[model samples]
Target: MSANTEGFKTFWEQLTPERVAHIGEYYTDDAYFRDPFNEVRGLPAIRKIFDHMFVQLHEPRFTILEVVHQGDTAFFVWDFTFRMKSYKPEVVQTIHGSSHVRFASDGRVSYHRDYWDAANELYAKLPVIGALMRWLAKKMA
Candidate 1:
């Protein structure tokens, strides 16, 4: 990995509440990101999203499986693990996802996007929709 990509990987792997508050080092002021639920712009807005995610998921953490970079962009293959805020002790629920990042001339991210099968990684793991989704997914497969 190039020095810049290595820097990005280090930033992501070490992300935490305190680090997110200082995301200006990693993202531009007008950076934009789109994912399943929302389209957000600016580092402050992005920080809010991350803040909420970390709050709602206990022990939230990312495990980097791979980092692939080409020129000014990179993809992080990762697995996220956490117990949902509403999780009961008897049940287990964890979320796994990945993100793609595009860098600007200053080495801060200009655009970011995430990829993951929401049905399988999130919705299908829910209590109500899980069983039905599992059934349909199996049928479709």
Candidate 2:
């Protein structure tokens, strides 16, 4: 593993719920997180974002597939899986995604960006949107 890859492993291991409250230990105060759907800033806001995410998905977990780091920046390719609470016990949907993260001097993420197909992974799981999204996914695929 590369230095950055090791750092990323350490970083992810430290991302438990309790550690989220003390986000300053891992991320700069003014860090930014960007994704296809949302952009969030600051540790406090970021904390809230994570909190909401934890509650939104059931058993949300990341499986790291690849990692590479240079200087203080580490990039991780991962797959995320979880169930939407709205689906309850009836359905278990999985979402596949990847992230690009940059760590600061203190080993906290300065920028976090995620890339994924919400339409194929998420919207396709919905009852109404699922039909249209699945149709679109089939066409695109």
Candidate 3:
């Protein structure tokens, strides 16, 4: 395995509220990050995103499924599992997604972009909005 891939996998699989503060160890100070819901640059903003994840979800965890690396870029396919802290806390939810990361010269992540289907993976799991999203999907299909 590439050094970047190994480091990233370890960082993500072991992430926690406490570990969120250690983001700078893996990401550059000016790193860019984007996902279905957020787009932010810099370590502080990136850390906030991760901090919010722990606050909004119950026991959120990531499981790496695959990794592909070439040059300074690595792509990771992963599964994120968690339960909503407020709604159906007992029901476990999983989202399949992928991240593309580019490593800086110092081996820290300089750019990271995540791809996922929020409508199907998240909005469709909500209480009221779920119904609407499902109906819309059916109609569109």
Candidate 4:
């Protein structure tokens, strides 16, 4: 672990839809953020993604499982847990993923790219598509 790695962990743990305003504290003004669904640049544009996350999901939270830091870069694996608003049984969903982040000299991330299995983590968990995804996985395997 590096000096600021703990702080970075804290920042991630405390991040929430209502607390997204603090993104600037952890990301540069011209930071680039990307995930499986969105690839965007700048702090304001990135904030919109976080804003939309809250709008679309209920009680979304991230649990940091591990952090690997080397030089000015770090990789954090996390489990994003949330509940689907459309589900009748209100099951809690979890997606295991990792983020590769490059930190600036000031300790703010300059670039963030997320890596995850979309088919297994998202589409395969769906009600209708899940069935098809399972069949496809069997065929491919």
Candidate 5:
């Protein structure tokens, strides 16, 4: 296992509200991170995003499925499982996605971007937007 990939696996596997302080160990000071609903630079801003996640969701977790590394860049596929705090029945939602990570010279992540289908993975799963998205998909089809 490459240093970058190993570090990523370890970091994410142990991620939690309390463990977030370790983000600096894996990400450089000037790291850039982005996903479907967020684009932020630096650790402080990135940490806020994570803090918000724990506050908004119930039992959110990520399971890495695959990892491919080449030079300084690595791609990882993962399954993100979580439930909304407001949902009573406690149905777990899973979003399968991939991430592109570029490691800095020191092996810390410098650039991180996640690739996922928002319409299908997130928006289409919402209570109101889900119905509309499904209807639109059917109509378009």
Candidate 6:
């Protein structure tokens, strides 16, 4: 792996609420980020997403499973694990997902997009929403 990729991996695996403030070090000032729930641009907006994650969940963390790099683009398969601060705070929830990132010339992320099945990975783990989501999925299938 390249130095940039290695640094990025280390950064994510060790991220914490306090580290959210330094997100700009890894992303360009005008970077773009998108996931199932949010799509935003710029460093401040990206910081808010990380901040919100810490606020809404307990011990939110990313475990990188695999990484592929080619030129300025990289893909990472990761598992995000956390406990919901609301309903069942004791239950640990894990979301399997992948991220596609493009690096800028300065070795910072210029664009990032995450892929994950929110319906099955997230909503299906919720209380009433989980039952409804599973039933609807079954009906559709």
Which runs of model 3 end up more than 4 angstroms from their true locations? none
In candidate 2, how many Å is residue 13 off?
Answer: 4.7
Could you tell which candidate, 2 or 3, scores higher by lDDT?
3
Off by over 4 Å in 6: none
On residues 7-104, what C-alpha lDDT tens digit does candidate 5 reach at each position?
78878866899878778988999899999999999999888899898998988898999999999999999999989887543889989999999999
Residue 32 miss distance in model 1 (angstroms): 1.1
lDDT string for model 3 (45-112, tens) is: 99999999999999999999999999999999999999999999999999999999999999999999
Q: Write the per-residue lDDT of candidate 2 for residues 58-138, one digit (tens) a residue.
A: 766677777766776667777776677767545666666677788776667799888888877777667888998778868
RMSD of each: 1.9, 2.5, 0.7, 1.4, 1.1, 0.7
| Over 4 Å off, model 5 | none
Q: What is the Cα-based lDDT of residue 120 in candidate 4?
A: 93
lDDT of 6 by residue, 15-123 (tens): 9988889998899999999999999999999999999999999999999999999999999999999999996999999999999999999999999999999998999
Clashing pairs in 6: none
Give lDDT for model 2: 0.74
Query: What do the candidate models score in CA lDDT, each in turn?
Result: 0.83, 0.74, 0.95, 0.88, 0.90, 0.94
lDDT of 6 at 56: 95
Candidate 1 C-alpha lDDT tens digits along 100-131:
89999998889989887788888876788999
TM-scores vs. true structure, each candidate: 0.89, 0.82, 0.98, 0.93, 0.95, 0.98
The collision pairs in model 2 are 26-108
| Candidate 4 regions with alpha-carbon error over 4 angstroms | none
The local lDDT score (0 to 100) that residue 133 gets in candidate 1 is 95
Q: What is the alpha-carbon lDDT of model 6 when measured against the actual structure? A: 0.94
lDDT of 4 by residue, 1-141 (tens): 986677778877777876798889888999999999999999999999998888778888889999999999999999999887767428889999999999999988899999999999989988799999999889999
What alpha-carbon RMSD in Å does predicted model 5 have with respect to the real structure? 1.1
| C-alpha lDDT of residue 39 in model 5 | 95
